[model samples]
Target: MKVAMIGAGYVGLVSGACFSEFGHQVVCVDVDERKIRMLEQGEIPIFEPGLEKLVADNVAAGRLSFTRDLTGAVADAEAVFIAVGTPSRRGGGEADLSYVYQAARDIAGATEGEKVVVTKSTVPVGTGAEVRRILAETNPGATFHVVSNPEFLREGAAIEDFMRPNRVVCGVESKHAEQVMRELYRPLFLNETPMVFTSLESSEMIKYAANCFLATKITFINEVADLCERVGADVQAVARGIGLDRRIGNLFLHPGPGFGGSCFPKDIRALAATAESAGAPLRIVETVNDINESRKKAMAAKIIDAMGGDVAGKTIAVLGVTFKPNTDDMRESPSLDIVPALQQAGATVRATDPEGVREAKELLTDVVWCEDAYTAMEGADAVAILTEWNHFRALDKGRMKKLLKQPLMIDLRNIYPVDEMEKAGFRYVSVGRRAVGN
Candidate 1:
């Protein structure tokens, strides 16, 4: 199988590499020449666990390649995948599908013979129809079958998710496209991965629905964490109790600042807007979006309150700044909200992340970026663990106490036990746990 992956961004790079690893020849096409150059030079532009090795192994085996020549890549490929970004529209929740549409037009011009054009980007319900329309309008005589095949890869664990996905969903109306898809994912058949075949619209809906539902679960738990705090209850125990139920199963039940990433924030808003446009609004999803935003914003104030209400002349140490661990992605991260708010309260933020410093340096400004968590903790009034990175999971309590100006700690991710911190003789604050342990 020969695959031309359009857009060598996160999705395209990972998917193309994985497909090539499955013994298929893959050429990742990107409009960005620098990105192509980087890939060719074996300098992975993004930080994903095992992705660098996977791409390198496949490229060494002559199974994977990268190019900015879209036409050359698309013309020789049997399956052309559109994996471009569809960001939320400005001042509106609708997805701006201009990139997806432009890719469709480009694919239409470059496609030779009968080609299966699969959309690997997360898009709206009627997007495939529009893509089909674009293909026909752009090249009236061309034969193109547009298939909606949205990706379900998690950021930090994208490679694992791609290689060992629970299921593969494809929106294929034509037999030829279905056959091509089946052959493309033939490697997964060995593992008996469920292949969901649905209509184009259903496939598109599935992606949004899945993301929004997970976002809802996060929001629900966050709200419960708030309630647990007010009612003198421990949210960790609460989460564990409910997570044992088969229905809940506890994935996104961890209470934190809020949900922020490439997918959740935009996907939920886009779904809400799409549903409203279709004359059936999703109130729960809409509320989830609103609540998550508020949750992220509220975390800064919580930190300030934990630090004795006035951080006007204080220096606060932020342990992690990325959205999650194992990835350097800073898009919509809770630190974006909390850091700025803390600065507004006249506090100096000393932050450190094992992998996020490079990207965070670009998004965050005027903060004192440090080499490590201990460096950030040095001379700070209080320390806050915003993202639960593994490095922050275990630290010397006595060393932390010695480094910090005071023994004040805020564990937003609930990474520490209240009793242990209390016994350690430090003033500890955590989410939905006992208040201000000493």
Candidate 2:
């Protein structure tokens, strides 16, 4: 199968590479000439684990390619995927479908044969029908089937998620489109990956619902963590106890600073907006958004409180800056909220992340970027663990104690236990658990 992936961002790039790895000829198209040039020179734009290697291997095998020429790529493709970004629109909280619409218009002009134009981007319900209408208006006599095939890949584990998803949801109206999609995903079909075929609207709702549910789970645990702190309970144990239940699985139940990433925050807002416009308000989702947003600021306040309620003249060290571990993406990271708040509270912030520093440099300007964790902590009054990276997990606690002047530690991700930090003779504060202080 020949696939043309429009908008070679995270989703488009990873999906195109994975499809090419499945032995399909894929051309990843983008408007950014610089990005295309970088890809042409064997440079990957993002730092997804194993993505560069996969893309390199596929390109070496002549199965995958990158181009700035969208028309040329779409013209010869059997399936054209609109994997462009649907960023949250300003003022309305709805998804901005400008990129998706632009892709449809371009594809309509270029497509020569009966093509399956799949909405691989996460959009509101009826977006597929909107694309179909636009295509009909643009081409007048072209035969094309618009399908909704939303992506469900996590940032750090995107490659694995794409290759071995729990299930694949494809929305199609015609038998021909369904057959093409099934055949295109035949490799996964052989692996017994259940592909659920449904209406375009259902498939669109599925993506938003899944993301919002996960976001709600994270927010629930965060709120529980706050309650645990006040009531002298352990959130980890509570999470484990509930997670053991067959019905309530423990996937996104870990208490942290908040849920901040590319998908959850934006999708929840968009979902809420969609419901409101349709007169079916999603109150839970709206509250989830509000709670998650407030949680980030509250986390920053916690760090400030640990530092004797004043951080203005202190040198505060942050251990991690990315939204999560394993990926360098800092799209909506807690650090974006935490760092600025720390600076506002009168603290001089120094931060270190294994990979997020480059991107963090753009988002965080006032803070000093350090060489490593130890450097970031040097002469600091307090240290806060923002993202739970592996290196931050097994840190030299004694050394960190020595590096800081005050020896106060705020473990937002709960990477270190209270007993362990107490053993190291440091004041340790963590989420949803008892604080260990001397």
Number of the top candidate by lDDT?
A: 1
Residue lDDT tens for model 1, 1-438:
999999999999999999999999999999898899999999999999999999999999999999999999999999999999999999999999999999999999997668899999999999999999999999988898889998999998999899899899999989999999999999999999999999999999999999999998888889999999899999999999999999999788999999888999999999999999999999999999999998888999999998878999899999999999988999999999999999999999999999999999999899999999899999999999999998998889999999999998999999988888988888998988887654
Residue-level lDDT of model 2, residues 1-438, one tens digit each, is 999999899999999999999999999999999999999999999999999999999999999999989999999899999999999988878999999999999999997758899999999998999999999899987898989999999988999999999999999999999998998899997789999999999999999999999999999999998998889889999999999998999899999999888899999999999999999999999999999999999999999888778887899889999999989999889889999988988889989999898899988988899988899999999889999989888888779878889778989998887888888888998899888783
Where's the lowest-lDDT run of ten residues in candidate 1?
429-438
**Backbone clashes, candidate 2:** 4
For each of the candidates, the C-alpha root-mean-square deviation to the true structure, in angstroms, is 0.9, 0.9
Q: What would the C-alpha RMSD of candidate 2 be, to one decimal place?
A: 0.9
Off by over 4 Å in 2: none
TM-score of 1: 0.99
Question: TM-score of each candidate?
Answer: 0.99, 0.99
